[model samples]
Target: MSLSPDVFTYVADLVQRRAGIQLDAGKEYLVEGRLQPLAKEAGHPRVDAYVRDLRVAERPADVQAVVEALTTNETSFFRDGTPFRLLTEHIVPALRGPNGSLPRLRVWSAACSTGQEPYSIAMTLADCVGPDTSVEIVASDLNTAVLERAAAGEYSRIETNRGLPSSMLVRYFDAEGTGWRVREQLRRQVTFLKHNLLEPPAFGGQFDVVFLRNVLIYFDLPVKRQVLEHVLAAMRPGGFLVLGAAETTIGLDDGWERVPLERGAVYRAVPRVPAWGLPTATSPVPVVLPAARGPLTGAVPRTAPPGVLPHARPAHVPAGVPAPVIRPITPAPVRGETR
Candidate 1:
């Protein structure tokens, strides 16, 4: 059943306004394809009639069903090897110390689908910080359906092979029939929660690293900036923000200083006050050794000088071979800002 252009526009506008998801003109097919099944399941005769019923329905469950169906949850294990490589080799070391005195290293996998991304991160952290390090992986998704699968930590063999290296795969996952299961220890390290990035981050305080990768492409410019701003606020100063290869913060917020790793890109927060100007009271006075400043002092700002966005230059690439691949693992809408 075909939906009138008028109905399509109405539904699309409602989705974009409420969910921050942009439905392009060509996505009419997607609306028809996804909603057709839902309409049938709901006992509606046709897509147009189903959409009409959805518009007048008091309960939001049907509306959410359409949104969830339309959402593209395509994700896989260890997607785009470069970022994970950077996370394990550089980002993790900088955030953590040798003794693991800090009880937690908080990492959020924003928009994590079916759990592959966070599990990949968990495997990397386990290897880098040692299995015993007290790291907390918070994986969240807008779709409750995917979150449940992620919490289960189960994966098909084909799904497991994507972006997953053979070596790390053997170390972190065990095979069960046609599926692979992430090790219980690695699985236990992560806590799966439901969250919507379009809403304010409800978890409070800053995180050491926030992974808001490919999900941004679904949003328009304003939503993207708003989401990035909120994600940045949740990230601690000097903490890492990883984006997808095709993505960049260049045109968006200036608060993030893009730090180019040997393999991939990471954005570090620009301190409100430069370290040289920080008051001793608010600083990590005891933690700063003369040697610690050596790295910061010599390091150039990742962003462009003065007015430029951080361009990918050869000089920014660290000298040395790339690190090994780790392994493939395997929210609410609020009208107003809710704390």
Candidate 2:
């Protein structure tokens, strides 16, 4: 059944307020499609009836259920392949620099859906860092239901098949009944929590790298600005920000300095300096060797000129590979190489 105009408006406004997702005029089917199952489970014969009850009054839990229902959670392990590639070949090496001990990375997988993205990140890090990994990952999504699933670290056969390399799958996941489960070693590397992108990240400290892919396209200009601001505040100086292929910070925020990668580009934030040139009371810039200035290392101010990068850029991601079909870019400025 179709959603009544009143029901649609109320749900749309509720979702927008709670998650910053815009459910415009043409998304009635989408709203209905997502909420109908929830309606049935709630014992309402129709979406309209369910929303009517919600309008009269609904608990926080009920509101959350509705918001989660409307939020898009389409994700796959290494969905587009570019972000992970950048992470391994470009971002990781840049952070490691050409010397010193391996640095522990603090990565925030924002808007992580059902664990794939974060799990994929964990696997990638594990592969790069080897047996003695010291990476700390916090994977957050507004939808608690997905967070719960993510924490469990289980995936169905079909889910495992997508974008997951067979070698990594066998190496990282132990077959559990019908679906595969992330091995404890890899699963322990990531912590999942419920988070909202419009607000400050719940984690008090700054992050070395953040994965915020494919989420901003759902938000309007104002909300997008707000989200970027929040991301900027949470990122350490020179920390990389990964956005979806179609998304960008070009006109939205000047704080970010774009760094182009092989297939897609990543942005880095310019850390603010204290007025006295002394370290700020909060998140003081730490003095370190030049090797420590890459994307996922500890925070430090960039002293280089605006056009120059604080860290050395790689020659290219893969030195030599046949040109495959590059993902189409919307002139949104998301496509590029990382070397």
- Per-residue lDDT of model 2, residues 83-111, tens digit only: 99889887887777446345678899999
Question: Per-candidate TM vs. native?
Answer: 0.77, 0.81
Leading candidate by lDDT: 2
**lDDT of predicted model 2:** 0.82
Q: Which stretches of model 1 miss by more than 4 angstroms? A: 97-103, 273-339
Q: What lDDT does candidate 2 reach at residue 45?
A: 84
Candidate 1 lDDT tens digits, 1-339 = 457998799779877976789998978888888889988987986888888888886367877777778888898888887888898778877876555454568899999989989999988887777545678888888888889989988888889778888897889889888888888988998889888889887887468898888888899999999998888777777788998877888889887988967546688876544444322334321222232123333333442134211222234436452422112111123478667
lDDT of 1 at 251: 81
Each model's Cα RMSD: 12.1, 12.8
Clashing residue pairs in candidate 1 (N, C-alpha, C atoms within 3 angstroms): 195-331, 196-331
